[model samples]
Target: MRFFLSVSCFILTFAAAAAAPVIEPPLPMEKAFRMEARRDGPDIALRWQLEDGYYLYREYLSATGDDGKPVEMSTPPGVIKDDPGFGSTEVYYGTATATLVAPTAGMLKVTYQGCQDGGLCYPPTTVDIDPATLAQAMDPAADGPVSPARPQSQAAFPLVSKAAAEPVDGPGIRISDQSANGVVGSLLDRGGVLFLIAGFLGLGVLLAFTPCVFPMYPILAATLSREGESLSAGRGFALSLTYVLSLAAAFSLFGVVAAWWGQSFQVALQSTTATLVVAAIFMALALSSFGLFELQLPSFLRNRVAPARGSGGSLASSAALGFSSALVIGPCVTAPLAGALLYIAQTGDVVLGATALFALGVGKGIPLILMGTFGSGPLPRAGQWMERVRQVFGFLFLATAVWLADGLLPAGTGLLLWSVLAITFAVFIGAFDQMRPEAGGAARLAKSAGLLAGLYGVLLAIGAFSGATDPLKPLAPIAAARSDTTTAKKIIKDSFQSAASAAELSSLLKADANGAPSLVYFTADWCVTCRVIERSVLSDATVANALEGVRLISVDLSKITEANRSLMKELQVIGPPTMLFLDAGNNEVQASRLVGDITTQAVAASAASLKESL
Candidate 1:
């Protein structure tokens, strides 16, 4: 009787603690997901010591800069679990280790996601540490056994993932969730290699126009644009070739890694300090563009970094810069790339992933290659215009850095800093000053541009003072109204109901809605695309009007947990902004399942499909 009473009292206390709205002390990052490494002859021995009660998602295990390149290094098979959130996903509990066959002198960018027994799941995180640093972190047992390698099981990692492997009672085309993303993924699933390659290559060409690819351009343009002699077509060809090859290699490697390991670069390190490092590097490069300091390395550092001032030096520099840019800039996923990545994640096939990425890289580099070839014949003759041109690029780089840093910093801080940078940039561009009456067309244009910049800068400053976070919305008057709001729209928020746990989501999916259909919206803090949808499409009143009576289940993936992760897997959703629809009978309404960002009209049309009047 005494023992039974003691157990019952312990259970009561646990239940009470679970019921309370209390925040538990978080584990130190190092202890929670500690990364350690050691040298085993030419090989590198790496281990992640997960604290007790914390589990690592095997699919999230990632390796970067292994084998002297950003290759998609593999991990041993993990213990399988029928997760409540993501059914039949593999996970590693307590401790896990992997080996790199031939380690190189480069940054070891590791990414992994884990959850505690408390039900909190961390967003995918990345750690870029030197091999030496990792070695120091986990000193190998002086008498420890060398890490012996093991082969991965083919059955365990079949081409098609078991989560989606099971046949569902849905339309054949419903495999992928969104339009472009879903369509391309469906084609790949149908096994058309030529279609996949041709489509992704075209998509790559399109992605080149996006902001993510901008960082690589200035570096290459600056390199090719020397004052003394025009870059000969032959040299330009060689340089562009080297740059393209290196970039393709890096991106292809990244695709393979993402396929094999299931982590996108953005998902891996979004809002992390490593992203800040990339911003800092670009800031330093911007200083060089301003002629603050020569980019050429010191004599002693030259040998260590790259060859000095010759054809070989130029080629080496081009290749290194290209590879480095691909690794750093990390092109944001567009529809085509997202489709390719989706295919890779579901299949874990590095070969197809690498090929698609290679094609995409080639397409992205086409403009760079063509411009370098034909645009080199301009005669600037090393005058004032040249310096001005360099300064223009300098300001561009600074602006880009500020833009990249925006996600990491708080909204107010980002706008304030961006405004200050804009002011500085304007000063260089001749803002707050009139041009000489006899100045050239270009000079007059510069002054005109600077005048506009100055006006915008002042507006930004005012917006900052008034506590407006969005740089685009630089008005003090609307600040209070905006500050009082939350989510896409007040009415939309009311329409959407939050599902915090797997049980809740399962119930929502299973619950009978009489005759109404339900739409499940997936979102997370790190998902920028989700924000875009909210700001651009979902905010439209017509779109919201169409969803008047349909059930809206909003799943907050930011609060990561075992149950949540499993639910995402069950939904076959790789990341955020997934819209899953279910009919009254709890069957997934495959016809209207949208992935990523959809247009306002597209959403309205879908809603129109749902209305009884239709």
Candidate 2:
């Protein structure tokens, strides 16, 4: 009986095992694109090991900088795939290699992107190459494991995995014909008018949460602050409707033009002159918030604000501001906008494009509608408290101005301005004044806040002269002096501390490598992201260790000049926080060029690559 029962149990176990679901592991992300780097004479070559079913999007695959500047990268003709958003798209499958002549040396990086046959797509991935090592064959085993569990043959100078590339503003960014194309074309073809409107409206709603849409907030907020007391919900909505319509009209029209021109309107808006003008507008508003001056618009604009009173800036101005803000302040090429633009681009149908953009604008304006209608109900009825709030907005405006000025202004001057602003604010809060014990709670609170601000301001002021660009690291020179962890720490002490003027930097760069490790880091005060890289990794211990004995030179492009500007153009470095590595021969180690923001690990890896070159 026992033997029979055991035999029956074995049979039941077998039945259960056979019945179990065979869950195939989802498509392997790593297997989607296996990348490797190799030498092609003095040039560098990259081979991507693509999975059987996966493919790499060719448009996003680009090579930049010296040795690795991709000269001819050909992708095997891909199966033509029709995408709902991008229309007819060509995507490559299987393994492919791109070869380019190595420039005389600097940072050589290859950035590429891929997608699985099923659906999921990878963002652009980057690989930094060491030009010196490219001459010699790379051992796949020496490539080492990317992590303990995963080994990547192309993972040596991996900074692409540093931080997920700041999410490409919205999903509308599609690769088509080697250019940024959007999904709207396909969506429009499939859905017709009603569906497109609803879709764009949803896209507009999603866009409101993005970084580009934020600047328009203060403009609307300040504009609406006056009418909150007297305007009824109906009047509020009516005015808001006008503003939304105007904004929609302008945004859609602009999108159409931008599409026709084959340029991103958002990029144009970021031009130095444009940003400065916007910053100036914000400054004016900030001053107004302080009651320094009131904006006196034309009678046409003033009459609309207080229709009955006819004394204030008219609602027409608000609408006009909305129109301009819709075009200028919010210039992100989101999925909705992209779709609309793509549709317009392919078919010269202005009506469809305008309607799509207008719908998106209406969606973006929903928050303003709510604010105009219900926002005033919670406010203290036009009292002293409102004045305080206005002041707070003024301070916020100042902060925004500073943020905008970054990358545009000189780093040292910008820091000085910040320190001055903090100190001035502290003084206004009565930090320097002695308060009696009998002081009210509000006064005491103000004093406490003032004192804290004052302390920070003092430190910033000291940092101005101490060769410290970072406010957080005001006393960093002292800490760096005391640090023992990284070679970068010592390099910072020995060489990087000396400030080179715009004139001197050209000659410094031309200086032959002193048979020791060296680098030239291009930076400006305005590049906020670069500051993050500098504080977190450039000064860290592991990187410092790697950079030990490396001569660190800096070229401040904050004050743009013919020499520095030409230098940047020649180097193909568009903006700040770009790191260029040099060997004992003083030639640029192209594979190790770190452009924009980089992670600490990449910096250490870069140092190791540089040391290896030596």
C-alpha TM-score for every candidate: 0.64, 0.49
Report the Cα lDDT for residue 130, model 2: 57
Q: lDDT per residue, candidate 1, 1-614, as tens digits?
A: 44336537744753554354432323434557666555544555556767787778888777667453554455777988776656788888866766565445666666777766544465567666555543211223334333244332222111221111233422221232343235445545554555556666777787776666776677677767642364577667667767876887788777666545555444554546656776787788789878888665456656654443432236657777788677554535455555566555543444555667777887888788876677656624367866777777777778777877776666678778878887887798886676678988987887788778878888888887787766777784565566876544323445677886667865665555465566778776556566667756776877777677777888876555666655654565555666766555445544565655567887776666555332
Model 1 regions more than 4 Å off:
1-185, 188-191, 226-228, 297-313, 327-331, 378-381, 476-495, 509-515, 557-561, 585-597, 609-614
Candidate 1's TM-score reads 0.64
**Candidate 2: regions farther than 4 A off:** 1-181, 185-195, 231-245, 300-307, 331-350, 433-443, 468-481, 487-614
Question: Whole-model Cα lDDT per candidate?
Answer: 0.62, 0.61
Q: After superposition, how far is residue 216 of candidate 2 from its true place, in Å?
A: 3.1
Q: What's model 1's lDDT at 99?
A: 59
lDDT at 234, model 2: 61
- Which number leads on lDDT? 1
